[model samples]
Target: MALLNQDSDENPTPGPPRTTEAQYVASRSALWSGVSALFTDGRGRVVLEDVDYRPARLLPGGAIDAGEAPSLAVAREVREELGLTRTFSRALAVDWVPPGAPGYPQGFPGEVIYVFDGGILAEGDFARIRLPEREVTGVRCVEPALLPHHMGPGNARRALAALHARINGTGPAVLEDGRSISPTCLDDLEVLRTPRKPQLWPWHTGPAPDELQVRQSWGWLFSEDGRGLVLIGQDTGSACLPGGTVEPADHDDPARTLRREAWEEAQVRISDPLYLGYLHDDTGSQPCARVRYAAAITDWEPPSLDEATGQTYTRLLATPEQAAQLFDWDSQAAPQLAAVRAAREELGLPAPVRQQLTELPSHRPIQSPAVR
Candidate 1:
């Protein structure tokens, strides 16, 4: 009689395996969970749901049903958990764990957790807000800075760290060790490295005549990640944050100018503008213009094609590291990159993980100048 191959056998003789009935639990039997970040009024105050005996103050989130999209699951969970109408910002993070991981409730042999940034609309009386009392015991709005003191173990800290980056800007911060805190929180600590500057030609064309000078405009610095500002492209070789000159038609509202410029350049529509600060650069000997604004973008959509030019500008979403790489390649954007890094650091943003790329030799390999 032919013998079964032990490695391929479906039912090989049991040895040290199957020590516990739970160990025999099929992976399919695992439950998936999601976490959410509820932003109230764009102030970076996030609502964390208190689940039964989980020992962590978590974002309002829950499990994804089999075959469900994580993004959809998070939105559904937010509504179900908070009983408030809301819309999610971009997906923030995804985490997975093996079944029976400590801290997870028993019977969850595996977990695929998704986290999203969301906004709450139509805030009702706290007493009237509906939640499944069995699963969620309470809901509280915790400031990003203060979350470390009250969040539950493990994932809560990671979620809070992302939130802090979203709120305070991107940079490094300290996280409590898992030995004394949840493993999820321990993973929240991150370091931001200096951005890499790009190489390109200078921005001076020997001062354009005043008649040809573009007026300085201002706009809010918004980001899809809620971390940094978005820049629009101009005739200058580099990219520029969305803002345009104060035209006679602008009606003296810099905020309106920002909105119009965003619509025109990036095709983005923004509401509820905030003031960041002013930036003036005349190094190029071009007409001097100063921009006054704040970096606060709560929502945005991708750019649409220009009806006239049919040209589409790319909207890049990057961490500080990636931005540095782009800046190093594009000379015109060097100043803007410096300004962004400075602004982020001055605002106490978390440091990014910095990696240095070695500089290439100045001389090129010998080759024919042209095949022609």
Candidate 2:
């Protein structure tokens, strides 16, 4: 039997009293609900179904029956929808939604979407599949990169955004125009479109005034062995520490941002970051804010690039002495080196050997006569 096959009109014994907007507008009380595996192939593509030709596509899964467990509901739904018997490894996330949200046509007061990490066991998983054509008109696997293109209005879009964020481990939902929608309190929703650009040094100017660019700075402290400190060099010819600017959607302790950035940029895992002082610099016109930390390398590895960017690099650690020398000679490496050294010494490491680079004035003359 299909999970959650009952109709709304049935009004099966009411569980909890239907919550109102006033109760949950600023409250933490949330309904307990469950959704099935936004099942992805090895390539991480999720299965989507078009319902009754609705503009919005949906991941297959449904609410848990009274007294039924969330994980059990997930497994049952997967079997009924995709004809696959699977097991749940763990619950990934419990999505909380507000009451009376106008997104779902079913008039669901709210939902607590529990995502389960699951896997199929047998080749017969694809056999004997029967889709309820009235409810599920069409089905296909949608690559995460293309989800936004197929997403419809309301809860469907929100679910896609949340799932995408969970899968990619990156910022607010990235839209087709490259715009991003960050999670926010309802009061702050109005400012979602306003771009917050990072302050940069005058020499670092390139993005237009209206373009949204955020500045992020972090320390990349490494020991002599290439194992302790991790760094990745981008094709843009800029050497940056592993972290980036903080976003509003980050829920972990702010310090986690340091570790998160390190993993993303250099694919190295950082733990126990010692708090360091913050730095402020201006690229002539733009202001940049940097939060520094001294961290121990609990684990390290080579970096991987997301599909959005094709550039790649290896992670390497260098001694303080070597770092100072290398940074002194390379223009791009100089500033990052200084920052890392300062952080290391603050954490009681040996004072880094210092090498100085002489600043040179620009040689190109302004307003030169054009050659015919």
Candidate 3:
């Protein structure tokens, strides 16, 4: 029987309410937005959230409510998700995810996400974390190296870019999709490289990335007078800095390698090592990153390298002008030399020592190439 006034042979229900086409269009025209907060644990580890209903891990924060500010929305989500009552410190970045990604379901529009700095958590705050069982299944502290696996490409970029901006004090960053605009902040950005032949320092294809490459560490030994130390190759009469490959025994510590190299090549004890930076070299089939450090000679003994294996070196000190003349601006040692001056100036040390042109070391440099 027809329920509503015996209408035809089909059963009918109550009429539904409706909205005008204008209202529908107004809603679809503007894109949706959300926010996430990056909470780290004093250490370089970040807090990642595992949603019960999703496969990918996300930062803790969510959607904006009607007529609510994004900042307020993020604070509310953080409160709801982490069981805390706190707002974000400030926004770290803004990323716009355009529509038409295959990852999204059919007809699903894209979104703009704002990432806020959730300030490093103290020990007490970390202990108080309580995940909402309905939305969050688990929470884990992810190291910097492991972030790429949890957060998708876009989010990982946002997190890392934000972290770098914070560390380098470069202010808030801006990203579209996932890459930095204008001044890219990649730490290993190749601005200067040695002009070695055959393959050259900066590969035509660019430097090989960290994951699948080898690393070498060196110490730019310096004195208070801004004089730098060099090790003269006994075999070839070439002048070069003290450094060597990052052996597996060093346990991935560049500083350790620097200390070991200084001791092995020159019998010099360098203290207070400050990492200057690196040069990404692709002069060979195996890509290499020559990590440079600045250190002051605390004490020294006679230079030592076993002559039995054709590995003997003599330590020599060069004034800044002389060193500059020795390893010109285009040499691989340029960054380290420049860094030595910058570091000394930044530290408010005395200016580099000046020496006459005749004081320059007279050495036949057959080949002073980067350590293989």
Candidate 4:
């Protein structure tokens, strides 16, 4: 067969050359890609770089070189920016940002940012960080709740979402303009966004003294597995055990208060509320005793709005160790560990291995009974 060529025709004049698919695609709009990593200290604070040229702090990373893979780019950036040699094996999040976002000037192309998991930095690792004065002037470790103070709205949101995605142990979360495309359980509850009040009060394995008033009651309500229940506050987003202050209806019994509050707050029915000692909280106006208990979740109905908080509490299952971390008990680790051991023994739960927190998704809403 003869080759078909318009230019070969006797009467034909030359026309513009046809463009291939690749050539046409190359002419279309392209998004710039930047790579960053999420590093945390032992206390779960994120490591952010203070860029000299930018007002807001940013995650430790930089723009990817042309034709560079994201993983390689992040590794290079870490070495150049933080003066640390590290390799990121997994991505925590991928955010698609539009033009005109912060740090992107008008008419600038959009970007896709890859946030990799930098893993927990130990004391030795922190000691090794050397900031290159030209770009990153300094470094600061900010608590997840305080991220907004240091970062722009979009960057803060993206960083928080990435942290929760790592805690959930799920694959990388996909985001658009720094919002989750499909919100995960942690995202839905807005975990780590709330500043959790420290519970460093002295934990006593002995009985609570009678002179001190019992003002609060909380439980490590366990499921069939070794996981305990945690309630994410609707108003404040703080995570706590599914219990509250002692109501008049509790009749001076802390266990009764725990059972009633668990039912009212999370539609959970717990049984065999075993005493796990008390925390002597003296920070308030007067010294008060906050009794703790360990129990098994016997049954649970669909979750409804907590009459007290006026919104449904996001319920999660976590190991006692995870609960301690969420409650910010770093300084009280010894007591917290003792309490966990007590809870496991009392609830007959085997020693718990560290596991990711998971949600108790219940769509059907039931009427919350009056506090009793």
- Compare candidates 1 and 3 on lDDT and give the better one: 3
Q: Is candidate 1 or candidate 4 better by lDDT?
A: 4
- Pick the winner on lDDT between candidates 2 and 3: 3
TM-score to native of every candidate shown: 0.38, 0.38, 0.49, 0.79
Top candidate by lDDT: 4
107-222 per-residue lDDT for model 4 (tens digits)? 86889999999987888998998878698899888878999999999999999989887876768899998899988767877788877676678778877888999999988888
lDDT of 1 by residue, 1-372 (tens): 233354564766755443333444433354555555545422224567778866767766766777877677777876787676555656544555556665666786566555565643324535456887688888787544456666754565456544433433333232332121222211222211112222333343223234433456555353433344434232221333467677778886666777777777665666555544343354576635444454444445556664434555445344443433223333344454555556555544544443221111223235568766
Could you tell me which residue pairs clash in candidate 4? none
Give the range where candidate 2 is weakest over 10 consecutive residues by summed lDDT.
355-364
Cα misplacement distance, residue 328 of candidate 2 (Å): 39
Instruction: Please provide, for model 3 over 281-324, each residue's C-alpha lDDT reduced to its tens digit, 9 standing for 90 to 100.
Output: 75568766766677777676655564333687655565554443
For model 2, residues 1-372, the per-residue Cα lDDT tens digits are: 113323457755656555455555646644657675655543334567777756777777777988888878988887776666677656544556556554455656666676665532223444455676467766676644356567644444444444433433333343221122444221122111122133232222222233323344465544422213423243432223457666565553446777777766666666577655444454447655455566656555545783334666444344443322212122333454455566666555665332221111112124568899
Estimate the TM-score for candidate 2. Answer: 0.38
| Poorly placed runs, candidate 3 (over 4 Å) | 1-28, 187-372
Each prediction's whole-model lDDT (CA): 0.49, 0.49, 0.64, 0.83
RMSD in angstroms, all models? 16.9, 20.9, 19.2, 6.7
Q: In candidate 1, which residue ranges exceed 4 Å CA deviation?
A: 1-41, 52-55, 87-89, 120-128, 132-134, 164-372
Q: Report the number of the highest-TM-score candidate.
A: 4
